[model samples]
Target: MIVLPRAMMPIIVACWLYYLLGVVVVGQYEWQTRDAFDEIRMRMDKVNDDNCQIQHLGDLYLPEDAVSHLPDIKDININPVFPNRTALLHLHNMALSRSFFWSYILQSRFIRPAINDTYDPGMMYYFLSTVADVSSNPYINASAIYFSSNMSYSPSYRGFFNKTFPRFAPRTFRADDFNDPIHLERISTRNTFTVQDLGAFPTTRLSDDYTTDFYRINEWYKKWLPDNVDKRHDTKTTYQIEIRYANNTNETFTFHGPPGADEYPGPVKWTRPYFDCGRSNRWIVAAVSPVADIYPRHTGFRHIEYPTYTAVSVMEMDFDRIDINQCPKGKGNSGPNRFANSARCKTDTTEVYI
Candidate 1:
């Protein structure tokens, strides 16, 4: 090897340092992204459910084609309804109540990271709003309790590499700050909308008001964004609708693309149940997050996208239907194979995790 000049040695060393910086920066970014998902699910799991209302619905299951099978499933224009003010407050606060790492922001030329645990209201809103916007299922938020768990993961010690990062998020996402997710608990009385003989379909975050009811929502969203955050705007969203049926089975559906014009016939997504003035069914609607390009593929963590989302949207809805069946404690989700103790069937609860 040729001997390098003394002056060149400093440049070589500088190059080496730059290389190490990328390794550390990239590694930190990847882990922070991975960990965000991990904490959310962990929080959701730790919380005790108030009780799944769906359990009461007799052991009914929606077939895969439940939506497509409907007599008029194709003729619907699914004008989504949104949550009420009380519910909105709860959702908005839960999202802004805590601090978190804005990993997506890391990629943004805009935001500059701060210290661990530094609160950034905007990122929280992004996380909360993204899930809510896609669909209004509470489980999506519930399972992501980690998003707000005010904990930090970046190593305390740093070399020159540390400088490469703007600043570690001051606060890690925490659930305690907000009530975790509103849906995980029983529907609040204020939000309850009963259907005569059937159970209730309390207003979820996905209610149309989220979009139309933009004023109050903005009060929270309008908060000072993390530095360099872009102004908020809407994007075309694709939501995968999941329903927990009466037979203790799951029915899944999604929008391959926008619905057709006119008759809106053929290959439509999500069953559009006619809302008779009386006597209707109850179900849970959980939302999954739209895909975020900032994250990597096969993120070991679950619930990153729909089975595979094309773009990031505001919310992800997962519905849990609770008809009046409380299937006799004998029916098994997989048949007699189901047990009361197993809490698994006529309870065949499957989730399309976001």
Candidate 2:
């Protein structure tokens, strides 16, 4: 073999050394990343046993062949058994595309929203709500499925990704607008009926179980523990829901969720024969903070610096109980979307036209 000149040998050795160093650096960085993930998970797993009771909703898994695509949003498709006000609406649990929501993956798994890609689970909390009534007059169905979107935390990449989707303006809109004309019937600033209905049906369903009148819905399950917000607001709201986790594993932790808006809170009790769950997006993920470590006292805003991921979700849902008038044939006992689970009624209403 011909021997290399001295300078060439140094250069070759330097190149080889550089490659070795890069491998080491990358491995170290990955290890650090994993360590950070462990910290986040440790913090997330801490459940305060003080004020609230733990209700483990369900666990997450790789999408099966049947549910690989998103399904009807209203059907409580994350897991069938856990009940909600309107199925405690657990949407999708997004991670770094390949990791669990809790694994510190999503924050760094930045992706560009391609053309016509509406929801980048990394970018926004797409709170999807459709007009609850599909009557001839779309505006009349002012009611909507309220209280969606868990608190989703995205890493602030140069500050663009950190801000919440402010409102309907030139830049963006609520994802619910995409729910098709049959459901979205022009209930916006344009409609006078929409204004009247928004005022009439202000039943903001909350993520947490709160104190209720305990009349028809007799639920005593306290909110998820390690309470950040003082108000278990749902307890005070007109309707309440409790989700018992389908998982028996003790590794479960209660994630903190953003409260649902009270402005367009739908009617307390209503049926939806008019609205079809099949017409809606099948799987919805309401992202929440994986770790909610601090909250400023005065503002009542939870200060979060945690990554977001969810292991449990509802794959299917059936209303635990609805009026005999709506689920007349005991359809409530059946899984989601059997008959007229669409009818909404008040606890006091004796005469339901539906």
Each prediction's TM-score versus the true structure: 0.21, 0.19
TM-score of 2: 0.19
Local accuracy of candidate 1 as per-residue lDDT tens digits, 1-354:
998899899999999999999898888542323332243334334322333222322122222212111122222346322222233233323332211122332223113343442332343453444333223433222212121111212233232221222211111111222333656764442222211100112335322121122212211111211112134312222335565878998855433222223333321122221111111122222111222122222233434422111221111112222111223444222122111132213436677979
lDDT of 2: 0.26
RMSD (CA, angstroms), candidate 2: 30.1
Candidate 2 lDDT over residue span 187-270, tens digit each: 433222121111122246332112233211111111122334433323211212233446843332333322222322311111
The TM-score of candidate 1 is 0.21
Query: For candidate 1, which ten residues in a row score worst on lDDT?
Result: 165-174
Clashes of each: 67, 39
